[model samples]
Target: MISINNLSYYIGDRPLYDDASLFIGPKDRIGLIGLNGTGKSTLLKMITGEDQPTAGEINMSNDTTIGFLNQDLLSYLTDDSILHVAMQAFAETMKIQKQIDEVLHEMETNYRDELVDKLAKLQERFETNDGYTMQAKAEEILEGIGFSTQDLQRPLKEFSGGWRMRVMLAKLLLEKPSLLMLDEPTNHLDLPSIQWLENYLQSYDGACIIVSHDRRFLNASINKIVEVSAYQLNMYAGNYDFYLEEKELRNEIQQNAFENQQQKIRQAERFVERFKAKASKAKQAQSRAKMLDKMERIEAVADEAAAVDFKFKFKVKSGRHVVKMENISKSYGDLNILSHANAHIERGDKIAFIGANGKGKSTALRIVAETESFQGTLQKGHNVTTAFYAQHQLEALNIQNEILEELKQAGSGKTDQELRGVLGCFLFTDDEVFKKIKVLSGGEKSRVALAKTLITESNFLMLDEPTNHLDMMSVSILVQALQQFEGTFLLVSHDRDFISKVANKIWWIEDHEIKEYPGTYEEWEWWYNREQEKKKSSPQPQNSEKKEKAKVAVEKPRHDDTQKQLEKEIAQLEGKIEALESEVTKLETELSKPEVFGDAAKMEKTTNRYQSKKAELETLNATWEQLVEKIG
Candidate 1:
């Protein structure tokens, strides 16, 4: 749907992209990736016409529409309900409905056939656009992206920036533009919302280009990978994992070619120098030199991955118990977070706190760190020293200090040489260490803060979302560092891959209590999914009698006659359930057809049939389960 040809963008004298080209098809799902400072976000802006490229052009079909979700949308504020804001995607449908309302009002006063006919036309147009279902569609998208039903009616201006960003995301998804572009979309989303978005994008009808640092999100959602590096756009046909393998193979082949070309050039130069001095074969030497000059050159591959060789050591080892919390109760206004919650961390434990937003993950972290006020008893282990790192901590770094100076101020008592080595592990090379903190980008500042946190002598660490603004390589380095660290740590992160790699225990908040699963994230995921399936299979009881009946059905054995009857009933229920499911599917297809929706009578009849069939299917499935239980 969109084509970028020979695109070149420059920031002053530095060329971020040169001779870059990419074609976005109608069904493309692209993951744009590169190291920080490689101009990923800038490319999105250029595509959306927010910024013009220094050269070349971007072209799209005349009818194509664009939807861009960027960080700037976080600042959007409005007093309208979130549902209303999302429903604004159907601007034409809403306008048509308004006109229909006006025509009906006029008919009530004038009692004219002309007004009735105009109203008929307007209502037809509204039905043709499926205006009646727009509100439900908006609500579904808002809830899918993590808004509560109650929050849907709340003013958009009342929410925080992150929440506001989710509202904007819902609006964009509802709009369903031809080309969708997102920049670091997962930054504001929790794990559940991220998974929800992944599922949505998997079935998204339009073309999408996503720039995100979360490796697992990219691998799950995107089919193609585009790397912005070395002043060019390099395309990979498959996902991020495939891109890694393919890029490695390509780099190896390129490296070999470059080496062979260098060898030939060296031989030619040596021949020219030796033979040209004697003038015996100077013509041949000159010809060889000219041929060498005209030959196409192969560029050597750049090593982008950083080696994380820095080791973390504590000044003093803590006791077996790193921290102990008991009877923890926290509240903000009338909103209760944790009540009488208990949790403990051991000296060697690595824990990950994860869940949807507004689940008190960050509150629990703050409580553990003892930085927030709570009605709780928290005890630190003997000789334990703690260091807490958060996004807000990024602001705590002295802007006047250079990167090396900041590390020295961390009080690790390390020399400048040792600190420089530590900075190199975080990808700060040569004179980059001399750059002031104020001039650094968000990612660069994050790396500097993380380096300081690692070099500290604390025996325990509390890192909240440390992987934000980090590239895949940087995240890998941080993972390696955490793996080798000797201290205990508890982290709150939405990155599932990061959690799975670093965490030996899983922590989550449920029913205003801290819940722990003493296993790896992968194990916890399996167990959690099984529990959810069990819940889905077992419906909640309306009263004690129904609950008791269900229990009796499961516990009691049946006589031969009763067993046969139960089996017969179960078979009948299953047949009915299958028929109802098929009916529901057919009704849904009918509802989606233009001929049905464009007429009010047909649309209402199809929708009512769809709902009735769905309800019938649910009851039949329930009956079949009860019959099977009785027989078993």
Candidate 2:
């Protein structure tokens, strides 16, 4: 058990906590939730000894090991494949394996009794550590967190910023610390990855604390909720939904008690005032006054922060057909992400683009917004004012500007008063509104992007993963505002809760086509569940040889004279790939050295080469596979 006894922390003049206490037991899956800048990360850091508490101590068992993922450090520096990092989680075990190898080598020549006894002890330790299955465990976890077999081999630098974080998360999970802490773990994950993480944490034997705005994830994974607000920490015994219920009840009790106390204080004051002036009751009045001074004050209800009411009314209502795409095809070189995808989005349609990450949910939105050029007849209806918020829109913000300045560019027509009002609604208070945009946290940045979307006042809002970093309250505010929004929106989100609330229509993007389904998220999910059940009940042949033959028949490739030439070239390419892979591995080892971090230019060059080689290797592998298929 981890006991946080009267913990207190301060940030400059601001006190984050006066005296906060929490008891974290094994199997305590706690959701650490709060608004932006409420010391959620700081609290975790204090517990992990990454940051010291201003006062009080965190008591824990001596044997406890902590595993933590820092939200601020999303970018990872490594030349090796993601698998290498995941494998590092078993660093102690890997070191043991190395020791075992050295022992075996020594045993080959030295037959001394002492050496044999040493080998036996080492062998026992190896089995105890489960060293044999470490590789399999690491691989299984990496796959579960969305790493493809090919992706596992690709250099860490080859992946985008989001994927790098996924690699980090995979490593942490593999570590299986006694206390697992993650801050906004679902921020960069897609739907399937988030689902996998929830399942992983649900079965996790150790105490887990996750700071996330992903409500569905919290509700599903956690059995407890701890709300940090107003320099106070409140614990609830159930999930997020239960927390809400308990919070409301607690608020009512506090409010009523506060009112009653106020009335008592008022009566006491009146009695003191009336008697203190009189000659006979002067001592009694003084006694009452002293009693009042020593009295404990009852706290009022938890003041809910002013929510951002995003009421974006379009300047002009678009035509009936807001967007029309006829056989729209998007390709990155030879990789056809979307091919002949046709869709017609009607005005006021709140559509959700749902699919796996690579299925082009964002691509379809970009096509609708006409931000990307595609090979198709993509038409916009009359007077369509479009605003697009990409997945990396927060990254594109001009960080030099203050929050107010940034919002000024967004809601150009609004007066300063109205602008401040909007900022306040989004939970940006007096000094916070003047804060530099660059200094904002992930959740804060997402809020700014959402604010910008509202400020643009476009009839067509195409938001790609808008809720990626938003907290529960922020999402609720956005959802409420969007519910009242007069404009049409196409949202690409993995959040089932967010989609279910705002999306009036569903655009299930699968393979290379858009399947427009007219239904709420609940209805679609019901149908999907039934479909899955149907597949489970369906019969299948047990003949292994027959199954293999059928699979080969379905995937067999044609061959000709061109295939013969390609096969010869394929052999040459394979040799080049092997050589390149060896060179890359050597470079990766060199890059991991501590001195490389000191040299910015050298790091940049190595990183560039690392990414480039990965890309080239990927291209070669794809070409080689094509050749092999043709030859077969």
Candidate 3:
């Protein structure tokens, strides 16, 4: 177990964490979450000893080993072979191997008993460390992280930034630390690589703490949620879904408690005011005033992020057949990426392009977007206006322009106020709209690009990993927007949840072939998992008297009870939201009072409560809508 005792970190006037304490167990699968600047990374750094806390300490077992996968892997990377970098994890074993090499060289020069004995000792150590098997392990991890055999031999410098991040991940996974901390580990992974990682981490015995914006990744891998905000750490004993539910419950309870306390405070103040002026009740009023002054007030809750309300409106209509391709083939030199791949996209078709890395998912998307030339009978319907959003679209934004200016340049044709409102819909408000794009974070830039896309009315959207760099809240909003998009879209994303919500068809790529699965992403996933189960458990059990065997490999049907439960929860959420709306109004009214201005601390608490309540309401509304959507 790792114990954090009253841990605190302060940078100048900013208190990232204050008096935070928690215990992490050996088998804990924790998802660390919060707003962008709420010290999630800082806390990880403190835990890993990369940075020191301003006060208190972290205590752990002496045998504990930590491995942290940073978001910026390129900073620490070298121009080494991918396989070589992975093998660096076995530092001790490599040292022993070097010693053995030196001893062997000495023996070749002078055959001495001492040299022979030294070599024998080194060899024994190497065998003890399982040095002989490390090469295979390195290669295995590299392959799991999406490096092809040929690619593993290539120098890290030859890969792009995303691929380099994968190489770094391979190194960290190979380390096999007792405690693993990953910051956005899936940010650069393909769908297959992500599934591979999910399988690996599901069976990982070490304590894992990850900070990622991927909601599906959190739900699949984490069993605990650690929320860092308002200079405090809050622990939730569940996954991301549970965390969302539990957080709302917590805020609701907190709001109730605050309301009760405020009620009592108001009563006491009234009593003090009415009696303090009368001589007969002056002594009692004094006692009441003192009691009121000494009361411990409940601090207001802090929101995770401001709400972003936006959606994409498909401005133009397209013909029935949106895109058609026949005998489509793409290759680089002698390497065939797409061998006569055939596919058809109809209007309103939501397609998810899934495949192993470098297996032509993006290539196919590029082909459809007409950004890459390929030998094929490709055709587009008449008046099939298109908009393409690349995975790295945010990187292509003009950083010199301000957020609002970018919107204007996109020809949104909205007034200044209208543009500000639209920007607010993506969590950009106030002075934030005037901020230069160069200074924005990756998430912010992605939101800007999305906002730009929203202003464009295109019937066909070729979006490649549109959710990249977005926070869970932003992702939820984007998913909602895409769900409402009345246009055909082809998406390339490793985010299973997002894909499941947005895509209605699956175009799987493998060996340069396009296998179209006719159904929603959820159906295709079920079919795929069922087949995988069958493949893993091939042989059927023998039956007596030639009895028929059960079809255990089939996907289990979702129980109707789950749907009923969701409905029940949805109804309950409506009630909670209504109650919360009332509470928010009360808080807002209190904050509006002129007397509140005199008490800066009270004003701050009230503002925080309002923000948190508002955020909770938005989340509840979103969840309720999603449940309703599933119901239909």
Every candidate's CA RMSD: 6.3, 11.5, 20.6
Tell me the tens digit of each residue's lDDT in model 1 across 1-632. 78999999999999999989999999999999988899998999998899999999999999899999988887789899988889889999999999988887777779888888888888889989878777867876788789989999999999998888888898898888988898888998999889878877877778999999898999999999999989999999999999999999999999999999999999999999889767779899899889888999999888887887867778999999988999999999999999999999998899999999998999999989988999979999999998999999899999999999999999999989889999998989999999999999888889999988989989899999999988777888899889998889999999998999999999999999999999999999999999987964563343234335545564566567776677566556655665675677568667545466434466566766777788877787677666756565
Error of 1 at 305 (Å): 1.2
Which of 2 and 3 is ahead in TM-score? 2
Task: Please give the clash total of every predicted structure, in order.
Answer: 0, 1, 0
Candidate 3 stretches with Cα past 4 Å from truth are 8-14, 54-63, 76-79, 300-315, 531-632
Question: Which scores higher on TM-score, 1 or 2?
Answer: 1
Q: Estimate each model's TM-score.
A: 0.88, 0.82, 0.80
| Runs of candidate 1 exceeding 4 Å displacement | 547-632
RMSD of 1: 6.3
* Top lDDT model: 1
Q: Model 3: per-residue lDDT, tens digit, 533-619?
A: 785456323221111211221123446787667656766866776678678767866754545522435645676677789999889
Estimate the overall C-alpha local distance difference test score of candidate 2: 0.81
Model 2: residue 200 alpha-carbon error in angstroms: 1.6
Error of 3 at 215 (Å): 2.4
The deviation in Å at residue 177 for candidate 3 is 2.3
